[model samples]
Target: MTMLPIQTTATAPVATPVATSTGDPALPLELLELELSLDGFSGDEASFAEAVRQAADQVGGDFLFDLPASGLAEDCLRIAALRVPKGENGAPTIVFALLDAEGATIRVENPDETTKDLKRFADAFVDVLQRI
Candidate 1:
């Protein structure tokens, strides 16, 4: 099946970290999230998320897998893509946490709210997909 590319404007996605506290002794989880609406896609959120997971896997050199967490909206799906460097060269970085919701909208999130990391992920994922 042929799939069209996701269009993005020259604007930047929100990279602010929203804090989620689990009330545990450990530090809170800070997440950077961005949402994209897929107006052209006719499939449901699950299908879109699965397609994204497959696409990320096809790129190779990365770990793309599902992340089943509680408290998300029932109509949403979440996954994670982690960049695993070759050998012991560099530490692994979580590329993004992909969350697809109803109305053909997909959200890309980074646990760490660093602007640089989010920019790298957007450049790698969004730019490449836009060129497709």
Candidate 2:
């Protein structure tokens, strides 16, 4: 697995779980910040699910990919994740997707690594919307 390293000033506090956590693994990362928006995602439920998955594919370090909920627009996309402190060479245990954001499905598996990729994924998602 490719390890994406995020440049940072200090390590962020281990994030709290959003939905039900697989297991509360410690995710100590710096307080990184990034924002993305759909602007106007005039699409059906299936499109929404696909778009969310595509965005997640860009941001690596994923530990789990649960079955998509029946209704995406009505369901909060949740991705459980975890990694050993050493690196990808480490095992993928399990953690919570607890970052609080509005109108965005987010789960930073490894805060130190996935920050940049998440931003890239967000940009790509917007591009996907514009193309549609």
Clashing pairs for model 1 are none
Residue 76, model 1: lDDT of 45
lDDT of 2 by residue, 68-114 (tens): 32332223443222222233443332322322223233433333233
Q: What is the Å distance of residue 85 in model 1 from its true position? A: 6.1
TM-score of each: 0.36, 0.26
lDDT of each: 0.40, 0.32
Highest lDDT, which number?
1
Scored against the true structure, residue 67 in model 2 reaches a CA lDDT of 36
State which candidate has the highest TM-score: 1
